[model samples]
Target: MNHNLMDSTINEAQCLMQALQSAGFAAYLVGGAVRDLLLGRVPKDFDIATAALPDQVIAVCRSRGWSIIDKLGKNFGVTAVIVKGVTLEVATFRRECYGEDAHRPEQVWYGTSLKEDLARRDFTINAMALSLQGDIIDPFGGQQDLARQLIRTVGNPKERFQEDALRMFRACRFAAQLGFIVDEAALVALSEFHTRVRGLALERVRDEISLTLIADQPDVGLGILVHAGLILEECRIKVQGVYHPVPLLSELGDLVDVPQNPAYHVHDVWRHTLAAVQAVPPKLVLRWAALLHDVAKGRQGVRGQNQAGQPTDHGHDRQGAVLAEKMLKRLDLPARFRTRVVWLVLNHMRFHMNFNSVLDGQGLTSLKHWVREEARSGLFRTAEEMHEAFDQLAVLCAADAKATGRQFGHEHEREKFLLILADILQSMPVHSRELRLVVDDIFQEETERRLIGPCLKGLLLRVQDGMLSNERQELTVAARKWLKKHKQL
Candidate 1:
C-alpha cells in the first residue's frame, strides 16, 4: 500500500507476517510491495509471500481468530486473511505450469522456497521480496534492474509471456507507471507474443488501458502499444458464440505524422494529441476526450483544403464524436462515461461560439442563453450537475487550447466563462420549477394546468434573455402573454 495512504495497513501486514513466523513458517512482503518500497513510492496494496503451505497459513489465521478466505488458497495456493479491518493477501510460494490458455495456469503446485516463487514471477522488478527481519531478497538481480529503471522478465521473457499474456500488457503499464524502460529483450518478446492478447478477456484489457491513461506518462505506455502493433491491429474477443475484433484506441495509431494547419499547430496530430492528453488533469474522461478530440482530422471525408491551400479538417469534431463512441463501446465502457466523453469531443470547438460577444463589452446577453440551453440538453439532471459538467468542459477546452503550443487568450476566455457560470448559477433559473410564477395561481382549469409546465419553461427562457424580471407579477403577466401566443400558434 502507499506508505502515505495506508500506514495502518502496513502495520497490520507486518503483524500478519509476525504471526506467520510465530507459527513456524516464513513470511515476507513480496511482489509489487517490495518494488514500491525500494522505489520510495507508496504501494497501492501489500501482498505477502510465505514458505508455509496454503493449509498451514489458513491454520495460523484460524488460531488467531482472523477472518480467512481459503477458496482460492485451496486450489491456487493463495489465501485472503483479514486482520484488524485490513485484508492482506497471503500466498504460498508456488510454481505454475501453463497450457493453451493464455491467462490461467494449467496446473499449480506449491513450492517450499521463496526462490522458486520469485523465479516464477513475471518481472525482475516484481520478483524481489522483503523478509520480516528487514532484509531484501534478490534472487534474479531485481534490485539491479530497479536501480537501472528497467523492466525485464525473471527467466525468459517469452516463457513468462506464454504463461500469462496479460504480463505483456503489465509490462507496458509498469513502464508508464514507474517511468522505467523495458529491456530490449522484453520489447522483442512483447512484439512476438502481442497476438496472445486476443486470448485474454476484454475487461482485463480495458482495465489495463484505463490505468495507463492516468499514468504519469501515458504517452510512453501508449507508444509501446503502438510499437507492438496492438493498437492498430486487432485483438479478437468472443461473446455469445461470435467473435469481434476490438482493438484498443483503434484510430490512435493513424494519427502519427498527420499534418495539421502548420500556422496554428507546431506539432503533428499525434504529438498534439499526446500534449493535450498531458495538458489535462489526470481525469479519465477528460483525458479520453483529449486523446480522441482530433481523431478524425486526417480521415478521408473530413480532410479537405482551405482557400489558402493549407490542410483543413472540417466537421472533424462531429465525426470524431461518432468514432469515439464506437471505439469506447467496443472497449465496453459505461454508457454514462461514453456519453460525457462523446459530448466533450462533439463540442470541443464550440467554446468560442458566443464568447466573442461577451468579450466585446456587450455583457453576457448571448452567453446566458447559451448556458441555459446547454443546461437543458438532458445531459445533466440538475442545476448542480450542469454547473459541474460545464466546468469540466471549460477545463478541457483550456487544456486543448494550451496544447495547441500557441499563445492565444485561452486563459482569459476560460475565466470569462467561469464568471458567466457564476452569475448564471446565482441569478438565473435553469429549470421550469424555479420560475417565480406558481402553476396553481396561473391556471385553475385542469386542462390548462398542463400548460403551466411549458408556460413556465417559456418564462424561464424569457427571463434568461432579460426580457422579463423574475418577480411574481412580471412573470404572471408574461406567462399569460406567452399562453396567448401559444394558443394562437
Candidate 2:
C-alpha cells in the first residue's frame, strides 16, 4: 500500500494492507504507483501486488462490502476494489509465458515471490516496488536505473523482448512519456525487435503513438522511434532494398531532407515541423496541425517568388489539407477529430495571408476595420467555426515563425507581427447562444433539427458578426436564405 497517509491513499488502503497481513499474506503497493512516488511525481492510480490468490483477493473485497472488477482474472492476474471511495488494483505475483500471439501470455502461475513478479516486468524503472512498511525493493538495481534516468529490461533484454515483443514499443513509449533515455542494450534490442510490431493491431500501435505525441517532448520521442527503425516501415520507404519503419504519413519521412527557403526557415522542413509541433500547447488538434502544417511545403515547395519577390510555398496550405486527410483516413482516427484537423490544416496559413501587408511594415490599417473586413469576407467566421480553433492556429503560427533560429525576421518585426495577430484574434466576435432558443421556437422540430445543426449555427454567426440581427425576423430571413442557398427550401 502507498504509505503516504496525507496524499489520498490512506484509511481503507491501510486497512486493506493490514487485512492482507492479518490473512498471513504479504501485500505491497507496487508498479507505477511506487515508481512515480520515488521519482517525486504524483501517481495517477495505485496498484497492489499481493501473495493472496485471485480468489482470496475477491473474497477480501466481498467481506468488506467493497466493489470488485475481477475481469482480468487468471489471464492477467488483476482485480480491482473500491475501498472508501478510492479504487485500488490488487494483482497476484506471476511469471508469464507468451504463445505465438505476443499480446497474450500463454500460461500464468501465481507465486508468493514479489521478486519474481518484479523480474517479469519489462522495464527496471517500472519493476521497483515499495513494502507496506516502506522498505525499498531494489532486487534488480531498479533504483540505480531510476537514478541514472534510464529504461532497461529487468533481466536479459533479448529474452525479455522475445517473451513479449510489445515490450519494445513500450520501451519507446516510456522513454517519451518519462523523458528518460533508453539504455544502450535496450535500444539495441529494440532495433532488432521492432519488426515484431509489424503484426500488431494498427489501433494499438496508433494509441501508443498518440500518447507519445502529447508528451513533454514529442519530437524527441519521435526521433527515438525513427532511430529504432519504428518509423521507417510506416513511411513505405526502402533502404538497402528493404522496408523502412516510418510511422504516420510517409510524406513525413520525405520531409526529413526537403529543403526550405533559407530566408524564412533556418532548418529543413522536418526540423521546422518538429519545432512547430514542440512549440504548441500539445492539444490534439493544434499538434496535428503543427506537425502537418509544412508537410506540403516540399511538394508545393516554393514554386516561385511572389510580386514582392519573396519566397512562397504557394498552394501548400490547400494541398496539405488533402494530404493530411489521406493520412488521418488511413489511420482510422475519430471522425470528429478528422473533420477539425483537416479544417485547421487548410486554414493555418490564412493568419499570415491577411497580415502580410501589415507585417511587411507597409501599413497600420486600423484593427477594427481589419476585423470587420475579415468577418465580412469569411476570413473570420462563427464562434464555433473559428474561436477556439483559430486561437489554436494563431498559437501554431507563432511557433512556426519562431522556429527560425534567429526568431522570425528582425526582433522588431517578430514582436509587431505577434502583437497585431493577438489583437486580431482577441477582437473576433462570438455567436449569440440565445439565438438557439429563438431558432427552436420559430421552426418545427424537423426544421429545427436541420437549422440547429448547421443552418442556424451559420445564421447565429452572421448575426454576431453584424451581417444579420439576432431578432426573430432577421434570423428567420437568414435561415430561409441559407436553406434556399442549399436548395433545401
Candidate 3:
C-alpha cells in the first residue's frame, strides 16, 4: 500500500492530524478514508481520530480559527470542522457501552488509546488507521483482510454484532459496495443475531437497503442478508419508518427460484431480474424498476404463457406496477417518484411496440397512421411527447433483454429511424392555427378536451408522418373520420 494518500482532498484532514500530533496528542486519519486510500479509491469524506479529548479537540479548532460543526453533542465524541472550505470530521479516541437494545451506545468514555478505539469499530477493513507521517496502524490485520477481499469484525463476530446489531447489515452493505465477502464467522454470528437487526429504525434500515440496492453488486449484499437469515427481518421495518404491518419487499418471497421457460430465459426468475438490474447503469429508478419488472412471474394469480407457448408473464407489466406502487407507497417514497416508477413498470413491455412493429419494414415511413389510430382509439393515453416516452421505454427494454441473455438489437436500423423521425417532426407545424381551425371545425367541446392530451398529440405525430396535411381542409377530414370512428360524435 502506498503510505502517501494520492487524493488532494485528504490535505485538510492531514493538516488537522499534523496539528494534533504537533500539540503532543496522538492523531491519525482513520476509518473509511484509510481503507479507501489503501485500495486506491478516493474517499468522498475525510475523518480524523485523535487521542485529544472532545473539549481539547473543540479548543484546538477554536485556536486554529476553524468552526465546529454544531453545538457538538450531535455526534458524541465526533465533531466536524470547516477549514479553508473543506469539512473535516474529527473524533476523540473513546470507548462506548451499548444498551440492551443495542440501537446506540448508552454511555461513552473518552481518553482511550488508539488501539482500544480501533477495536470498537464495526469491521476489520474500517478499523485500520493512517498516521500523519504515512505510517499504517492496523493491529487487526485489516490490510491482509482487505487484500483477501473479506468483511470481518474487529473481534468475536457475535460480540461485535451484540454491541451494535446494525453491524450485520453494514457487513452485507460493505460486501455489496466493495464486492467483498463476509467471513464465515461473521455470517454465522449474523444468523444467530438476526433478531437484533430488527431493532434498528426502519428509516435507517431502508436507507441502508437503498444504498445496497444502488451498489455495484447488490446481489452480493442481498445474498448475505438471506443466508444470514436477515431477509425476514425486513418485515419488522415499519412502513415509511412508522406504519404497521410493514409493507416490505420481503413480500416478494422465493422469487429467485421461480421457474422460467428455457427458450427465452435460461435462468430462474430471481436470476433474470437481478441480471436485468445489474445490466443497467446503477440508477435507483432503473435498478428498482428492473428488480420489480417481472415480480409477478409464476405467481398463481398472475396471467401466464404467451401465444407462442413460451412461459409468459402475460400481464406482468401492469401486475408489477401494482406491486411496485404498493411497495414504494409502503416505503414512503415521493408521490411523483412512485407514480413515474409505476408508470414505467406499467408500460415497460410495449413502449417499443409501435416502432418495433414497423422496425423490420416501414418504421420510418410516416407517423400519420399511428397518430390517426391514437385519435380514433378511445383509450389513447400518453403524457409528454412520444419521442421522450419512447426513449425511456427503449432503456427499459434494453435492461429486460440483457437479463434474458439476449440483446435489444437491430441497432443501426433503429438509429436511422430516429434520425428520420426527428427530421419529420421538426418540419411539421402540427400545432398551427390552420390545424387548430380544423380541430375546432370537427370535434365537440367535450371531445376537444380529450384531444388536447393524447388525441391531439397523436394527430400531430400523424401530420409529421405526411399522412395528413397541415392544411385546414385536410386536417378537418382526418379529424372527422377519427372522431366518428371512435364514436366521439
RMSD of each candidate?
3.6, 6.6, 6.2
How good is model 1 by TM-score?
Answer: 0.89
Local distance difference test, each candidate:
0.82, 0.72, 0.73
What are the per-residue Cα lDDT tens digits for candidate 2 across 305-401? 6676655678888888888888887677887688778877887676666556677666445444555554555533364455566566667777777
Kindly indicate the candidate among 1 and 3 with the higher lDDT. Answer: 1
- Candidates 1 and 2 compared: the better one by lDDT is 1
Residue 408's lDDT within candidate 2 is: 44
Q: Candidate 1, residues 85-129: lDDT per residue as tens digits?
A: 998899899989999887889999989899998999999999988
Q: Who is ahead in TM-score, 1 or 2?
A: 1
TM-score (all chains, Cα) for each model: 0.89, 0.79, 0.80
Instruction: List clash counts for every candidate, in order.
Output: 3, 12, 3
Provide the lowest-lDDT 10-residue window in model 1.
Answer: 1-10
Return the candidate ranking by lDDT, descending: 1, 3, 2
Could you give the candidate ranking by TM-score, starting with the highest? Answer: 1, 3, 2
The segments of candidate 2 whose C-alpha lies over 4 angstroms from its true place after superposition are 1-12, 234-248, 300-313, 360-382, 409-489
Error of 1 at 355 (Å): 4.5
